[model samples]
Target: MDLKSYFNQLTTKERELQFGRKAADPLRHAFDVKRVVHAGMNGEMVPPPLAQKTWQDLMHQKVQGHPTQMAYFHIPFCKTKCLYCGFFQNGTDQAAEDAYIKRLIREIEMDAALPRLSGAPIQAVFIGGGTPTSLSPENAGRLLSTIQNCLPLANDYELTLEGRIHDLVPEKMDVWFKNGVNRMSLGVQSFNTEVRRAVGRLDDREEVLRRLQTLSSYNQCSVVIDLMYGLPLQTQEVWQDDVKTLVDSGIDGADLYQLDVFEQSDLHVYIQKGKLPPAATTQEQSAMFSFGKNYLEAQGYKRLSYCHWARNNRERSLYNTQARCGTHLFPFGCGAGGHVDGLSTMLERRLPAYQAAIDQGRKPLMFLMRQSPYAPLAEVIMGQMNQSRLDLQKLIRMEPRLKGLEFLGSLWEEYGLWQDNGYLYQLTEAGQFWQVNMTQTLLESVEHLLGGSSQIHQKKVAAQG
Candidate 1:
């Protein structure tokens, strides 16, 4: 049977039954796969546990002067629900939004009031969500005002806001620009109309280009456009044009996403019906990603991660590079995560639960992820995976827990996975092809160890539900 038929034959119950169980073995296998691939290329491997410990120590290190500099915010409101989106964003609710924003402001107040956050100048702040720009211009204004009032503002800091092409209209852009938002990331998933329809996004190419041009006119912020490949019917030809359109737009950066289908999304519904284009196989998606990387790099964009590329001279892009050293802060809404001086924390998620607690004057902290060695371990994994390159000595100096350099060296020799310049270690073609395995190894390793078998099953259920 074809992939669609194969997917269809598995009942939700059967799939759910196999969910986390299936991941455990494959995820474990991926590590060895990673080793073999790396070994083949003279890449490296370090035991994850050792890396985790080293990472945690890095996070808790309190040098006399430097402190936490990371912050994150979540705006859970969206103008419309896209079929392919899996983030925790909901359609707009004016009253609920008003309430949530007030709670968010309260949460920020609590964070600012914390002694740990007070003295440290924030190095980076990322405002993300369902669609932050979905807020009415008035609320957007208030939201900006709220952040300014609550945080210790850093003049040279990187401040990013998420927006859509339609939402980047003059009035909304004006509000965002006036408020010191130095960076804007537009959610322009695809320029192909049919592809947009296939994924339930609706920005026309002309409108997308025009809006980006308008954003370019703004002197206050750099612009980053988000593009997606691997939609139901997307071909490499189509995706290359999408990249060309983005390159032609003169934006500062681009985030190239491959379509990911969670069983809960409407995209899954189409998948079930075979009405949508078949999901691109991993091999196909990798090729598309390779195409994008080659095209963007040739156009003068620096690759920041597997999916993010930026012009060499952009400020926010520079901050991303600096953040690789673990100085970035992420203090935002529930579901948003980031690192600061190695510490990790999250605000809260359920709006009502979060708001109700904040209403009673409680800081809306769902949980503070204790600084553990795993924090930096995870960061290295994410950062390296995103950039697809590792500066071995630099990473070791940054966290010092990577005791497996020799092991990595062993794997590199055995598997032919990667090659080294004097300073940087980058993946070979085989290593590049196994990008998903690399990401899965890091993420799934954490998930399994932290939450174990039940948690995986629960996520599977959540995806299905």
Candidate 2:
């Protein structure tokens, strides 16, 4: 049960089995992780369970004093689809938007009325969507209004609205500001026209610059721009330019993403057609990652996570740290997911199915669900891993159930993962590398518990059957 040996045995087999079965079914790869996680939920074997204590704290308006924190909202509209987008979103008529909002309000009300929630102050309210700003500014205002009415918000609460460059016109910006939206995540994938066209995101760099300038003039919010590397036409030089733009623009934060070729995306078709460049080799991608990391660090931006960077640590997203745990939030509309401390729940992604559920006086709250006792433990580990930092003592205190993970303590001692200051636990640089593998370690542990393949001996088990 050595963690490293266990991972080697399990993952090596899983990969071999996956490659063997890739053409046979193409869909069952990683099905163990997928299926077991699902089956655990449906069978009610998932544990630690939902954070009732956290909710109770909220209901009593004591969340500010609690260590759990969360914020969530859903914008169910999109102007256009990106080739690689997997989240729920679709272009819809104004009527559909109106109907979605009505149901959304109901969902929010239900969450507010949940028995465990009485007066918990929300730490953050993140409104995300196909493109949240795609909704009419009026609708956006209305949605924020609903949230304010339903939840006790912290005075320094952070409200984030996901946006597209084209959507951030003066009028929209005005409405967003008035509605207490204090942060914006502009989805500007790339400024290069050719690359933008390749990915189906129509972002005008000059116009986007103008919008950012306008945003900078606002007093109430911080701005974060999203960037992606490894596009079809993107070269290392081009991506570097994009990174430079973020540094030069005075943006508060940046989320840098790597291109992932999903099986169902149009990019897959492009890959098949030989229209896209060969996928960035892992080595090349690592170089790009290092360049961005080093460059951003030199520019005085704090490296918040593997892919997230912030300026002076001022515009940090609450979700960036594991400072909070097991706080749940409700998402309304199509394809929105609701995650509580011990549970991972999502609504149906199909618009019609979700809408029909709404029309029937129900919120589409259960398309898929998983409640695990280990969720809080996983969150604590993963959250620290995200900051590329970990605190061992705080982690142990957060989940007393994990006190039995004594071997982990031994491993920490053996590996010197953290430096103990008698008061604080901080991850060493070597520990950061291990943090990147924590999820894999956790998953491999589950596989070992299930008595499955080890030593890179892969297996393919279909969930559908």
Task: Give the alpha carbon lDDT tens digit for every residue of 68-165 in model 1.
Answer: 46577888888777777877456789998888777777667755665556666776677888888888888888878877777777777788888788
The residue ranges of model 1 lying beyond 4 angstroms of the native Cα positions read 1-64, 318-330, 338-345, 377-385, 391-405, 408-416, 422-424, 439-465
Task: Tell me the TM-score of model 1.
Answer: 0.76
Clashes of each: 34, 17
Residue-wise C-alpha lDDT for candidate 2, range 1-465, written one tens digit per residue: 543454345455554332111222222221222111111111132232333333333344433345444566777777788876766466857998888887777767766775344345667778887788888877878888878877768888888898788887878888888878888888888877778877777866787788788888886688888897766677889889988988888878988875555556666667777776555543344456667877988888887675778985568766544233345664556676666544455676777787776667555654334455455555565565566555556655765433434444445544455455565445544343233333344333433433342323221221112
In candidate 2, how many Å is residue 173 off?
1.2
What lDDT score belongs to each candidate, Candidate 1 first?
0.62, 0.61
RMSD of 1: 9.5
> In model 1, which range of ten residues has the least summed lDDT?
34-43
